[model samples]
Target: MITVTLDALDLSALLCSRVCHDVISPVGAIVNGLEVLEDENDAGMRDFAIDLIRKSARQASARLQFARIAFGAAGSVGATIDLADAEGVARGLFGDEKTKLTWSAPRALFPKNKVKLLLNLVIIAVTAIPRGGVIDVAVTGEAEAPVFVLTCKGSHARIPAHVEALMAGTPESGTVDAHGVQPYYAGLVARAAGMQVGFAIDGDTVTIRAEPAAV
Candidate 1:
């Protein structure tokens, strides 16, 4: 029988905790909004609450879907992501805006884990742009092992350095660094996956790739 080290198990739990901590804010907001709507008595307030609930729900769903891809167990070999639903989730992250999100993927349950990771990463990419812009998300599998790729390009300024290191899994400690410059919890997630993550920045394009562990 193969035994796992305590450190390894602890690291896995720590990573999972990080993922939950990162996602709880958006998901918790949805729950809180729902509670407020259930008890509020004002008509205008109720309408506002409804919008918040919808927005929060979409946000929570997107995070969950993204988590499933990034950290959850991968079930089957070939699965597809629903482009329309994905677009809706992507749009939800941008709030009520004119951001255009174009999803090019088959409509099916592709690999659950891959889809989750891609969704989270894409949302992270889009969130970096505040002024709203066009986003294209695509997914494909390779012959050797399944692979997922996300390419985000916007006319907004270049990708932030911290984010670049986070995607590349090379974050410095906030306390020791000159600035509180560690990547967000999500970047810690990419690192925990034990996958080699890479970032390519050219002109106005920021391409990120998170590949599954090679077997």
Candidate 2:
């Protein structure tokens, strides 16, 4: 059996779609807030509108910052980033979502590839639990081959079908859409880092790992 993959352009398209999908909600909330403030004469309601705008603005900014670092070429070549920064971004991305994050990494800088892989793995894990749950991320091993383990658990924790297909290098369809591109990108990034990826799933728990610590 053969799986469908995304080409460069298709991948680009899907990434764009995903970014837009995430950014739209917060931005739309800001607009709604503005409308509420304009139409509401009650002081309390106006205050509520203001709060909504503030929260939505912050969330929008957080998501954008996370996406910039996670999805874009925001860092210099061969640069290492602070793990705290990644954790903060992850927290911001899950704002108001039912998911919780537990990070078990060092405070030191991590190679850009490893940082990216960690974030992508977070995305995959977060998306796996639609009913909300906990995400535990850890990093260890030699710097040359840092190993990462991501565990996702919740009431309905499970890997996405698209991710499974991409991981196996054989998607069920010919084109990789936005909803299925993160896993594909994660695998690609893992390989580029001179690492291998593996996963295990048991009932409500799913684990993903990257080996040979990326440089």
Candidate 3:
């Protein structure tokens, strides 16, 4: 008899895909805003529109840069990155938005791949709370292993069920939206990287933890 076991490694990839899925909307919004701002008329309206474009663009860029490390792909081996750079990516994403962010991580604990996945999920969680909320992110890993813990809380928890299901690796075709797409892509990436993804809901909040698997 053979039994299959899905570990944290699998979860990481799944969550990475989920991260990609969720980011498209806001990213697209940034693109649209840019197009509108190009020929924007009216000084007052243009200023207002510029501010909106800047904020959205910042958010999109932050999410994409972070996701590249988290969901899309990994960086070069032993590539040393500035501590402030990592935090800056997160700050750019978490700041100037309705969501509040709190982060804690040791120096160079995660590889580029892990960092990207973690940051991607951070943006996803923060966005889940549109009206304003709090997001907590922590990084932990070493030569033996590494992991990330992400928690997002808000007054109204409106995370779609399909998104949660995607995180769990059970996605449906009809409900496959941007949010679910990220998880689906993440699942693929995680499999390639040998990692796992885990997700749970707490009251009105959701938490996801991802880690690499042992060979």
Candidate 4:
């Protein structure tokens, strides 16, 4: 097993890199749209720029919302966040991409650490479906001790190897950059919460489960 030690600064840098990567496209689009609106004299072209600006702004907002909860202290401030809110954030995170979601969580709230883990797993599912697919996220057991199960299956589904290495804490590279940050953080959160996280990948499917701490 490979041990990786990451200080607070290292984690912050990698996480910021991840967020910046996700945010760049939409923000760039917004900038381009503004430039087009300023330079284009045609009314139709200006209207097109306006539409692009709106769409990109919304996407940026969604990504920020998703990241704030998934990778930041957004949930920590409140101790727990509502399931419905999490679902909404999940929906926004995927946008109208080829990936779809079927949420089966109970209509209850989730603790901050668990919520963060759940969102990280959701990101894992989203990345698996490069060619598009469905991610079914379900939670069982009581709110006081919830178990989360997420299955993501589709054509060409794959969980990035760096993420797998981080989960196992056996990175051959001896270092984790942006690719492994999410999973590493998720694992830390799970362990800190006295939870166990497991994953099984078979063919074009990946199943991720998180069980509550033993009594």
Candidate 5:
């Protein structure tokens, strides 16, 4: 296995880049819509531009909210986050995506990091099915020791090799960048929470499972 390491500063920088990348497209769309409003005199075009602005603004907000929880510190150390709130941000993030999220986690509080890991896994699962699909998220066990399972089913669903390597902390190359830091960060979160994350592929389905680390 190839061990890849990054300093805290580097990790933070890469994660910031990832979050910015997620929201930039929608923000750019909003800018384009504003430009249309400013330069165009056609009422029909102005109406379309207004609609585009609204949708893009909402998309940007949703991506920011999701990143705030998934990639931010979220709260003071040792704080707990409500699963319901996690669900809300998750649904928001998936709103404009081709994929759909079906969350079945309990409406209880879990450690903030654990919830962050769950959300990060949601992102990984989405990538597995780029052509769009259903991500069924389920949590088992108690709040203090929950197990997160995400089943992603879609046509041509497959986990990228680099993603698998990053999540396993054994990247093929010893370099981590914005494009691959999220899964690396997810691995860090799991380690911090004393959990183990695993991924399995079976035909067109990808399963991501996280549970307590083995003794």
Candidate 6:
């Protein structure tokens, strides 16, 4: 497998840029809504502004929560994160998206990095089905050495070529920017956890599987 590495500072900057990119729209919408609330005289317009503010606030919160786990130091090294919590954040992140999440992982606690990898994979899976679809997540085997299988089903579902290249650690993926950083980070997480991630596309379904790295 090809290996990819980046300076710690660069990785952090790219991830931060990505997180900002995800939440900026909603945050900006919230501000716009507030402005409308302040300036609009029509009662109907005021009600619309309030509704927009509420929804945008929720979206921003969800993205932040997901980023906290997926790209942040959620806890002390070696700490464990509950799968149930992971499911909650995953659902939250999917709340406003066309894609839906169906999680089947156990409710037990697993290593922080494992949970991080799962969340990152969820992000990648949802992207496979941009036209709105269902992503079914299943985890099997022991908690410490579990396998993750995410099946994404939707019309015209397909993994992006850049994402594929980044996941494979190929030089052809080019510079790691905000758009490509997440997949690269996901690959890093997998390797850090002593696991390998693979992807396959079958018709309208894309399956992402991760398991113990071959010795």
Which one is best on lDDT? Answer: 5
List where candidate 2 sits over 4 angstroms from the true fold: 1-7, 213-215
lDDT of 1 by residue, 14-133 (tens): 557756765688778877878888899999988887887787777667656545545554345454454455555555555555566666665554433344555566756665454666
> By TM-score, how accurate is candidate 4?
0.92
Residue 192 of model 4, lDDT score: 66
Provide the global lDDT of candidate 4 against the true structure: 0.85
| TM-score for each candidate, following the candidate numbering | 0.57, 0.91, 0.64, 0.92, 0.97, 0.96
Per-model C-alpha lDDT, please?
0.56, 0.82, 0.63, 0.85, 0.91, 0.89
Q: List the pairs of residues colliding in candidate 2.
A: 3-171, 145-212, 145-213, 146-213
Question: Which sequence of candidate numbers ranks them by lDDT, best first?
Answer: 5, 6, 4, 2, 3, 1
Model 5: per-residue lDDT, tens digit, 1-215? Answer: 86888988999899989988988999999999999999999999999999999999999999999999998978999999999999999999877778999999888999998999999999999999989999999998987788999999999999766887897778877888888899999988888888898889999999999999998
lDDT of 4 at 170: 60
What does candidate 4's lDDT look like per residue over 1-215, in tens digits?
76887999999999999999999999999999999988999999999999999999999999999998888887436498788888889999777788889998877877877788888889877777788899999999876678899999899887666776786566788888887788888878887666887778899998888898676
Q: How far is candidate 4 from the true structure (C-alpha RMSD, Å)?
A: 1.8
Better of 2 and 6 by TM-score: 6
Least accurate 10 contiguous residues by lDDT in model 2: 167-176
lDDT digits (tens) for residues 1-215 of candidate 3: 12223455654655656666657777777667676678778787677777777777777677777655555434566543544467777787666667888887776644554455565576567656667788888777662266777787887765645554555456655334444556555555455455776777777787777787666
Best by TM-score: 5
Q: What residue runs in model 3 are displaced by over 4 Å at the alpha carbon?
A: 1-60, 71-74, 77-84, 127-130, 158-160, 174-179, 212-215
Clashing pairs in 1: 66-116, 69-113, 69-116, 69-117, 70-117, 79-109, 79-110, 80-108, 80-109, 80-110
List ranges where model 4 is wrong by over 4 Å.
75-78, 213-215
Q: Quote the positional error of residue 111 for candidate 6 in Å.
A: 0.9
Report the Cα lDDT for residue 137, model 6: 98
